[model samples]
Structures are given as C-alpha cells and as structure tokens.
Target chain A: MTEWEMVVGLEVHCELATATKLFCACPNAFGDEPNTNVCPVCLGLPGSLPVLNRHAVELAMRVGLALHCSVEPSIFHRKNYFYPDMPKDYQISQYDEPLNVGGRLDLPDGTRVGVTRAHLEEDTGKTTHVGGGGGRIHGADHSLVDYNRAGVPLVEIVSEPDIRSAEQAKAYVNELRAILVAIGASDARMEEGSLRIDANVSMRRAGAEVYGTRAEIKNLNSVRSLGRALEYEVRRQVGRLEAGEAVVQETRHWNEDEGRTSSMRSKEEAYDYRYFPEPDLVALAPSAEWLAGVRAVLPVLPSERRVDLARVAGVAETDAAVAAVVQQGLDGLVTAAVGAGADGRLALNRAANELAHATPPDAGAFAKVLRMEADGRLTATQAKGVLAELVSAGGDPEAIAAAKGFEALEGDVVAGAVDAAIAAHPGEWERYAGGEAKLAGFFVGKVMAATAGKADGKAVTALLRERLAGR
Target chain B: MALISRDDVAHVARLARLDLTEAELDQFAGQLAAVLEHAADVAALDTAGVPPTAHPFELVNVLRDDVAGPCLDRDEVLAMAPAAEDGRFRVPRILGEAP
Candidate 1:
C-alpha cells in the first residue's frame, strides 16, 4: 500500500443557547410543539423584518473569545436561495465580514488547528420527510417543514485545512465544545443537533504539496460519526486515486447506517447565492470597553485548567490520571479535596476512577477519605468503599466508613491473619521458606483475603517475613 | 453597460419561482438594468474614506432582552398558510435534499 496523507478541515455549526430566535422574539427552544414557536419574522411574512438579537451576538462573541478569535466589525447579508423550509427566499447570514476571524484551537495532542472564521448565521427549519425508505430525503414521498428552528442563531466555525488525521479532528472538536460550554455560549450537544459538524476531506501522497480533489461530507451530527465519516471518505478517495481515477469534487452525505458516504450534489450544480448586504441589519462593531468586559467575564477554559490541575496536583502535565479527572468535569471535586488537605494525586485518582459515575461527596468528606487512606487509617480498598458510599449518599465519611465495617485492622489483628495464612498454606509456606521470594505476593494475597482486605499490604508483608524468616 | 440581460432575468425569475412570459422578461431586463445603472452611478462617486454601509441607519448593537415575548397562537399562524396539515404549513412535495 502506498503512503497517503489526509488533509481535513471542519465547519462546525453550534446553536446559541439564547432564549429567543436570532431575528425574532419566538422562543428559541427545541422539541416543543412543532409550529408553536413560529412568528411573522421567523416565518418570513412579506412585511416582517429582522432585528439582530443582542444576546445572540453576545453569545457568539463569547464563543469567539473562547476560541481566541478577533471580534471585528461584521455585517449580515442576504444569501439568496429558495427552499420550502426557509419561508424567506434568502437566509440572513454574514458574508464578507463576520463577527470572529482568525483564531486557533490547540488539540490535546498539541496540534494547532487554525480557525479561518466563525461567522453567525440562522438555522433552517427541519423537514421531516414521510413515507420514505427510512425517511431519508432521497426516497421520501413528501416532506413537512417545521419553522421552529428557522431563525435560531448559529455560529459556524470554519477551520483552516490543518488537520492531518481523523483523531486530530475529533480532538479539535472536543476542545472547541469544552470552550463553548465553559464560556456558557452553547450547550454544544451533538445528539440534539445543537452542535453539527461538516468535514472537508482530501488526500495526497506523502510529502506532496498540492492536495487532491476534496469531497465535503455533511450532516456529521455526532463526534463519532465525524471521525468515522472522515476516515471512510479518505479511504474512498485514496482507493480512487490508486485505481487511476480522478476524484470528483462534490458534496457527500454521510449515511451513518451504511457507514459510507454517498454523493449529494456535484460542484457543477452548486447554487449562485447572489449574496447582497442585508439592508435591514446595520453594522455590529463592539467598542473596546465592551470587548474588555466580555474578556474579563470569560471563565477559566480547559487548556488553562489542565495546566492548573497538573500544577496543583504536583504531577506531570501529561499525567493521565489528572487529565482524566479534568476531562470528566471532576476537576472541581479534586480541587476541593486538595484544598481541604487531601493528597492531590490520591484525590485525582479516586475522583477520576471511583467517583466517576456517582455524585461527588462534599469537599471535606472527600478530603477526609483521602487523608484516612494516606494516614493508614483505612486500607486502599476500604477507602474506595467509603468514597463510594459518600458519593451515593451524602454524609459524614467517618460514620459511613464505620457503618460499612471498613475499620482498619489493629497490628495484632493483621499479625493474627498472617499466622492463620501461614498455618493454612503450609505447602506454599514451605516454598516461601525455601527461598521463593515470589511466594511473598501469594502470602500477601492470602492474608488480605483472610482479613477481607482490611489489613495493610505492607504490614502483612512485614509480619510474614518475620514469621517465615528462620524456617 | 448592460448588467441585467434578458437571460439573466429569466434565470433569476426561475430561481425566485416567478413564471414570467417572454415579454415580461424583456421588460424586466431593461428595468433591472436601469436600476443597476443608478447603483453604478453611486459606485462611481469619489468616497475614498467612506465605509461600506449595511443599512440606511448608523445603528449598531440593536438588541432585545433574552426574555421571550408572546408567540402567536399556532392555529392562527397555521390558518394563514396556504395549506395546513397537523398544525404545520404544508408545501408541495419537496424534490431535493435539505440545504
């Protein structure tokens, strides 16, 4: 197989979580009664006009700032096209100018993908095609348009063609979603279509400068589908290239059920949108003071949080345990535990692994569990149990620990368990006395089992060594 | 300069779903060219420091509170549509895929 490289760029459209539609006062909600959210403005009645929503603009700016983009003077345009879903013949979108331009997102693997622009636009109404094969548009008998989502505010973030693989694309999207969520700009829910991805994929030989013809894969509603569709498209293009056929540039739709992309429309059939400046909406240029205020209010984002977590935990920046805690949104619990005097690494591990699913206990309770484990008041297994109970039912950690019978064994109790193990496993003990050092682990396991894991492993080892040394 | 030709008018009319006759296309072509000529007259002006204007007014950041106001009754809105089904506007069979 010849070496091939994939070049990918992503256009992510995230719906702003504003309370109303972009140009109208219709409630910007989803999954409500189909046509209940319709209004003259969103329905595009003849006399209706658009008034830019300030809250939507603020949300868009918050996204841009989070992505590290420059917020410039942007204007809306009428992208003239006709569709039944859009009662207006044209969509009100930003053309030559956009709210955000030229930002960069750094993936977890340290690949910097440049963002070309994040422009504001309106979402079209949904069309539920009926009597079709699987209800797809191609074989549908007819379709119904619900104008509820017609004027919902959207920010389309277009990335520079800098992604090298499907994994990087997924990482870029994950980081961007975190940023959007951190800044309270969008929920970024891919399942609900609040966040959608369109991937532009092409391939070339290794070290080639010019790219092969690219195919755009649309309607990648989830991150998993985004990566899978890009991979499938890249392989298809490489297969065509190796077969000595020229790849045709076209827009393709991802048939997720089939796990392949099918041609939607060719570039030859592309529409001439005839975009003209929207004469109703005026220029949107934020003053320096306003920009500063937005910047000041931005919450600490993921990248900064990662560094802070590593520093606070006294671990390497690439520590998987710390990274897992931060990625799972459990960094707050870990931070609170560390602040209340729990060992940072212990807190990170327990929160990331044990308390991952359960609700986190109070800060002081979590810290006490970690401290108890550290001070040898509880065995590691017993500490996890206490933490689990604390998560499932909020209470004093000590009371829960005692109630669960997780009390630490006294020294004599551990010694007695060690003697019992030695007496029961005479044959294994003989091998251990005959200079089989590996048998130490066997004895330790037996002692832990005998004591129900309440005895410390180190203490058990010491007692076993003392008792078996002379034999 | 003839900016709007008869063919151009016909193409735009088709896109706009406007079924115009040959005579109507020809008349509208000439009228659209006149309108373009007037726009060209404005383009020819010496406004070196002039900024591009999106609207007639010099307004920026005109916004409403995030609070949602009253929505029109669904039945009333659906009644205004040419055809209504299941409380939604019913159009002709859509031939192509969604944009």
Candidate 2:
C-alpha cells in the first residue's frame, strides 16, 4: 500500500483473422477439429515449402498504421526452440526487423502507451501438458498436441513500460483490442484465445527512476483478467519488497481461478533456442507498389474517426468516442445519415444516446440498424423494436420491426394519443391536478403504451406537457 | 562470435521456453551470437527516416453487416477437440493457483 510506482509494459500476441495459417494454406479458423486444419507447410513436414499468407502481412501493416508506427520494410527471422508442440523445433518470427516501431496507443484519458514494436510471426502449435498435480516436466504424463491452431497468424505488439497502474494496463489492452478488431485485422476475441496477452509488471520506489526486477505474467486472456493479474502481481511484489525479499525476474502464470500469478519457471532453468534467419522462406520486403496498395486500403482508425465524428457530426466529444470504438468507419454512418437528409446533429444525438445505449453487445450489428433508421425507412422506436424482435428471431432487424408495426408515429398523431390517454387515466389525471405532478410520467407512459411506442418519446413529451399543463 | 558459457546459453534458451540439452545450448550460444552479429547488417542501411513496415495489405476496415454470422456447429467444432466435457475444451486438471 506504500507509494510504489508500477513500471509496466505489455507483449500482446494477437492471432490475426487470416483465413489460413501464417505461413501455410491451412485454414486459420479457431475451434476446428484437432489437427484437421494442418497441412505440410504448417505441420513442418520434410521438404514442404512454406509461403506467407498475404492477409497476415496486410493485417500487420494495417495495425502498424493504426498505432502510428512506421511501417518498415520488415523482415522475418527464425527462432529455434524445442517444445512438444512446435513441430518445426523453431518458430518463424520477427526479431530485429519488426513491421512497426515507435507506435503509440492513446487511451480515452489521453495517455499514450508507447509501442516498442509490432512484429509478425507464425504461431507454434499448442500443447496440452498432461500430468498429475505436480511440475510439468518432472512428473508430467504424455502430452497431446493440437496443430489446428499451430500455424495461425500472429502479430506480437510490444509496448514500452510506460504504464503506471493496473487500470491503465487494462485500458491499454481494451483500447488495443478495440483498435485491432476495428481494423478488421483480427477478431481480437480473448475468450477464444484470439487475443492473448502477457505483461512485464515491475515496480520502483515511489519516485525512483530505476526499476525493480519484473515478473512476466503469461496467458492473460481478458482485459479485466489482465488488470487483475497486474494488480495481484503488483501487490505480491510490494509485499515481497516489504518483507525484505528481492523480486526475481521470471515468467509467471496467471491462474484465473485464484486471480493471482504463480511461478511458472525461472530464467535459471532455461536452455537456448538459437535464433537465425529462416532459410526456407524468402525475405518479403514488399515493393513500393504493394505498400501503396496496402496503404490505400487502410481503413480510418478509431481515433481519427472519433475526431471526425465530433467535428463533422457536431456531437460532443464523449458521444463521438462511443461510436468510434469498433465502428471504425462510423464517420461514414454519419455522412450517410446526413446524405439521406437527416439532421446531422439529431442523428448523432439519437445514435449516441438512444441508439448507442441500446446497441447490441456486438457493435457491428448496432451500426447497421442505426443506418437503416437514419435513412427514415424505420423510426427510432422501430429500430429498438427490431433489435428486440430479432434478439432471437435470427432475421434482419429492419424487416422484423416492419413486420411488427413498431415504426415511429408523427408529431400530431402522438399529440392525439396523449389526449386520449388523459381521458382514459382519470384517476391519475385527478392526482396530477391535485398537486401530484409526479404522475405525469405515468400518463406519458400510458400514452406510449397505448400507441405501443410508435411515437417519438421526445415529441410526445413536448405535446403531453403543452396540452396537459394547458400552456 | 566468442564462445559463451553453457549457463548463459541455458539462461537465454530458458527465457524463450526451449528445453535444450547442454550440448545444444552450447551450440546455440555460438549460433545466437552469430545471428545477432548478422542482424547488425540491418543497422548499416545508409539513410535514416525509413519507417519500419509491419504489413503489406490495405489497412481498411473490412466492415460486415452486423447480422449474426453462422458459427461453427457445436458438435462439429468440438469433434476435433482432444478432450471436451460439458461443452468446453477440457485439459488435464491444473494444480496450484494465484494466491
């Protein structure tokens, strides 16, 4: 609890959303049947040639651009290692010549997490270390290997230890995940191991510039979990330092069940996996024509789009942020809304407040409905209704809402409905007149309920107050 | 490259998660040093201001309509799992946890 500062950085190994493995033609789909997606190139069969998946390169480039990193003519290198799952006995990864360097991830609070480097690599196959409740190598049983995920494309984003707290680390991951998924380079789903994280959490005396020995906590799968792991590690290190014990640098594993980090192993126990240039694969320093093609295809990044949303849509800063998170080209949505003759400010307000809060957890779906509603084919109420009707309907929202007759009613019709509700709710009406204006909401609800919410609530509220208060 | 101690080789290899024999570790110390020395060639490139490139494709958002796309069939995706119990990928019971 003392004033110790955390010097934290992160290494995020994101599985690119490439259809095929990083250096092979095998399908890169997650959750495939074990080993079924493997091919000669990925499985490392003798005499098989490996080719880079073009999508992997593009994805790494797009992410590089988004992070504001210089896209170098990066090259790949081979990292040799002997493990049960790594069939090649060496993983083909980038070392010195990474795709990006000096990039930054900007938080909502405007803190920039400096990017050390982002590199491309062919992922190693996964291994299940089977054994009794003991150490892995000393007393482990036979291991089962899954090559299905072996050749998946991966981009390892390494950040400078610029983070100061556990919360910032979490925000960094969340923001990075949002940006990556927004770029469409990856699904960025941690639940399914698409976005895997490892943190280098260290500490120093309250204002000391020198850092203490850091522990690397591995296999963090979620943003919240990453934050918790960092917090737990920080506390443990602080406790160790307080108890006159020095923190040793080592790799630790996050036990999600216990919400803490346990020592996986230490540097004293390691052996060399000599790294060298990969001979089988040709060096892929892209030509200018190719880089131009890739750059031309770059989507508007989340931050830039957010700024545009504020300037072009004339919405407040906070509202612009929500639309920018994963809806990368949300500026297009506003432009489209405006092109359809919808008021830009009104569309943004409705989309951010009403439509945003009501957005399905999946952002991609929310944007489509907003577009349809903004075009005036469907009303705001109809949009909400479509979301509800199609919650399990497995059909399109606009079509479903139209089928259910939930489109927005005009201003005068809403006023008439308000008149009718007053007559029907005489008891509530009496309460309002008898110094109980709090019942106003009840009457408004009655009108909405009578019309089945086809009326715009704002217009209905205005008309209700004008007629009911006799103004 | 000068020869490195087995201990140093072992230490670096361990950081990277490779269980190497003593001989392999020694061999790798030489190889790693040579690789690092070779990598110095990249630093020798003439003029600066060259941005390191990470990818080689159009960096646009491949936006898809947010309709629920088809997911893998439960039985089908799980069919390839080494072990599946109760609709999840089950591994050998892991011991010890974060304290």
Candidate 3:
C-alpha cells in the first residue's frame, strides 16, 4: 500500500459590497423582493449598454492589493454559455488579461498560499428548481429565475495548488474571510452566499513530483462543507486508484445532507464557453494614483493583527487563543486592556474565552476587572461574573462588582473559611498534610463553596500549606 | 482546403443552442470557411509590432459613479417574458448547473 498525498486548490468568489451593479445602475443588494433590483442592463434587454461602476473597480483593487497582487491592465471577455440564470446568455469576465495577478496569501499557520489571479466578473441570477427531486435541476418541472443577484460585481480569487490537507484548506478560507471583512471588500458571510468556494482536489503518491487527475467540487456553502467535500473526494479518488481504476476529471456537487460528492457533469459534457473580448466595455487600466490611494487605505490585515496582538499579549502569534481573538475582531479590546496595565495573558484568555459569547465591554472597564483579579481584589470566578454583567449591560466595572456583591474577601474572612473547610473535610486535610499535594484542590473546592466563590484559590492554598507546615 | 468543416459548424450551432438544417449547416460551413480564409490572408501580413486590438475605439476607463438608479417595474418586465410566476421568470426545466 502506498501513502497518498492530497493536493488542493481553491476558487473563492466574493461579492463586492458596492451600491450598484458592476455594469449597470441596479442595486447590489441581497434578500429583496425577487426581481425588483433588476434593470434593463441586468435583465439583458435590447439596446441596454453596460457602463462600468467606478466603486466596483476600487473594491476589486482593494482585494487585489491586500493579497499583494500586482494590478494590471485588463479587458472583459464575453463568456458565451446558454443558461437561464444569465439573462444575457453570456458573462462578461476577464479572459487573458485580468486586473490582478501574481499574489500570495499567508495563512495563520504560516503556510503561504499562492494566489494565481483575482479577476472581476458579474454574478449570475439565482435559479430555483421547482418540483424536482430535492430541488435539483434533474427531474424538475420548471425553474424560476430571480435576477436580484445578477450583475453584482464579484472577484473570483483562484489559489495555487499549495494546500495539502483539509484543515489547511479551512484555515486558508478562514484567513481569507477575515482579510475580506477587515479590508471592507465584502461582508464574507458564507451562509448568505456573499462568499462562495469551490475546491479543486487531486491525489498523488507520496513524494511523487507529478500531479494526478483532479476533481473540482462545487456548492461548498461553508468552510465546514469545504473540508468535508475535500475529504470525501480524496477518499473516492484514492479508492479508485487503489482499485487499479482511473480517476475521471470532472465537476462534482457537494451534497451536504448525504455527506458525499456526486458527479455534476463529466468533462465530456462540459460546455465550450467561447470567450471573446466584450465589445461594449473598454479596457480597465487603473491609474497609478488610484492604485496608490487604495493601497494607502488598506487596513492592517488579520495575519498582521494576530502578530501585533500576540506581541502585546506576550504570547506566540501562532497561539490558538491569539488567533481566536484576532478572528473575532476582539484584538483591539485585548490590546487596550493590556495597555491599561492589565496582565497580557489574563486579558487575552478572558477575551478569547469569557467574552467569546458576550458583547465586548469597554476597554477601561475590562482592564479594571482584570486588574482586580490580578491584584487579589477579586477571585477568578468572581471576576468572570463581573465580566458577564459588564458585557451584558454597559457600566463601570467596579460598580458592577459592588452591585453583584463580589467584594474582596478580608484576610480574616478567607482564613475563617479555610479553617471551616479543613474542619469539615478532616480526612482530606489530613491526607493533604501527609504530603498528598493533590488534596489541595479538594480543600480549595470546599473553601470556595463555603465562601460563595469569594475566597481566592491561591489564598486558600497558601493557608493550607501554612497549616501543614505548622503540623 | 476549406478552413472549417461541416462538423465544426454543426458543433458550434449545438453550442449556441441553435437548430440548423442540414443544408444550412453545409452552407454556413462554406461561408465560415471563406471568412476564415480572409482572416488567414490578413494573418499573412508581416506587421509584427502592431498591438492586438480588442475594441475598435481607442477609449479606456469609460466608467460611471456607484450611485444607483431606478429599476424596471416588475409587472412590466415579467409581462414581457414568455412565462412568469411568483414574481419571477419561469423557464423550462434546466439541463445542468451553471457553468
């Protein structure tokens, strides 16, 4: 048996958050009354000419620049195909010359994925198959077309075959989504179809230089679906190769419900999309000044944000907690808390864990809470409770703590609780005094329960050790 | 020799979703071949430095602002379609997914 290595590439299509369609004045919105957003140019009426939208070009360039792609002079080509979804019977897309070329995206795990090209194109209308088996095209009574999504500007980003595993593919998409949202290019909500992904997967023998036949998987609605589709496709392909059968190159549809990949269309049935330069639109050569303006406005991307946060938090940038904070856009709050003299590690952990569900509180208020925990003014459990209140309702952290009755336990009060715990758990305390350090946790739990979680665990441990030494 | 064959014409017509008669296929093949022959004559010229032209006019960056304008009425647009239902254009059963 030979070990097989999977090679994967991805095509991510993101809709630009523009006010109008790419080539017309139709509104570029989602979830409206089906055909209300359609105009003559979007509906492909006769005598309708497409004029390029300036903001769409700017947003596309913003994505390209963020990916480090070099802007180039590009022209639109009419990709002719007969589809009911496209009212024009063709899609105006960049062919030989694309706007952005030769870029790279650095995944959070330090894997650099090469970006081939991110070209701008118009999106097609959505079609809903009626009275079909599972609303599929086959066995359908008819299909309904909603032109709301048509003519929306989309940037189709194609990645090189640098991905090696399903986990890496998900990471790549996650990082890409973060960058998209960070740069304000797209909302990148995969569930709402603002962002779409198609994975091209192939398998080769381990250490083999040549590649194998690849299958392109479509309809991956989310990052999880992308991972599952690739995993299933890799197994299917490797199974065929092991059986001395050949892998057929084709486009496969990912059935999320069935957890399998089925052939949508083989290469033999693939359409011949005859492409030619679109005569209606002119070449798009962004001016040097315009590119400079876009580049200047590019925000610090998620990868760099992770590095900055990790540095501020005194942790490795590759730390999972750091990645989580940056991905959730809570790094700013964490950084501010650290700047306000809160312990870096504690601030990051709370933001990554405790604040994961709640709305982030004010930086100063959050830092005050962390300071209380660090300075022994509040126990860890009490601090978490205060943070919950602070997140749910905006208020001063100190006032919230006071109102919640989470005051710092006096030294004598904690001592009394520890004494009571030792008396109640005599056997456990005897074992702890007899050098069973593991019994420390047992005593601490008793003290915490007795003190209503107001006594600090460290204080309880210290008192227990002191009594042990006296004995 | 003809530049294009009858089979090539038939394949192109099929791709375009056009139903062409056998006689029309032969006729269009000859006509397309003649057009291709003329292109070959132009391709034979030795103008190496001339850049390829995508459009006739020497214009670039004909753009519009991002402000949205009015859209067509749904009732009027759907009225023009051959079939419509549920505020959408109703078409026959689609063959396959979008390319």
What tens-digit string does per-residue lDDT give for candidate 2 at A88-171? Answer: 777888877787888999876667899999999877766565563443533555455667787688999999999999888888
lDDT for model 1 comes to 0.86
Worst 10 residues of 1 chain A by lDDT: A265-274
Docking quality class, candidate 2: incorrect
CAPRI grade of model 1: medium
lDDT of 1 by residue, A1-471 (tens): 559999999999999999999999999998998989988899888888888888898888988888889999898888887788798878898879999999988765546899999999999998887777887876676677789999999999999999998889998898899889888889999889999998989999889999878998997988899889988998899889989999989889999999999998775343478788888788899999988888898998887787888888888766777667877888888888899999988988888899876766788889999999999888888888888788787898789888988887888888888888889989999989989999999999998888877788877888878997655
lDDT of 3 by residue, A81-143 (tens): 888989999998998899999999997777899999999999999999999899998899999
- Runs in model 3 lying further than 4 Å from the true structure: A268-271, A402-405, A410-430, A433-435, A449-452, A462-471, B21-23
lDDT of 3 at A346: 97
| Highest TM-score against the true fold, candidate | 3
Q: Which consecutive 10 residues in model 1 chain B have the weakest lDDT in total?
A: B90-99
lDDT value, residue B97 of candidate 2: 26
The residue-by-residue lDDT of candidate 1 on B31-83, one tens digit each, is: 99999998889877898999756688887887677778788898888888788
Fill in the DockQ of model 2.
0.05
Weakest ten-residue segment in model 3 chain A by summed lDDT: A265-274
What is each candidate's fraction of native interface contacts (fnat)? 0.70, 0.00, 0.90
TM-score of each: 0.89, 0.65, 0.93
Question: Comparing candidate 1 with candidate 3, which one achieves the higher DockQ?
Answer: 3
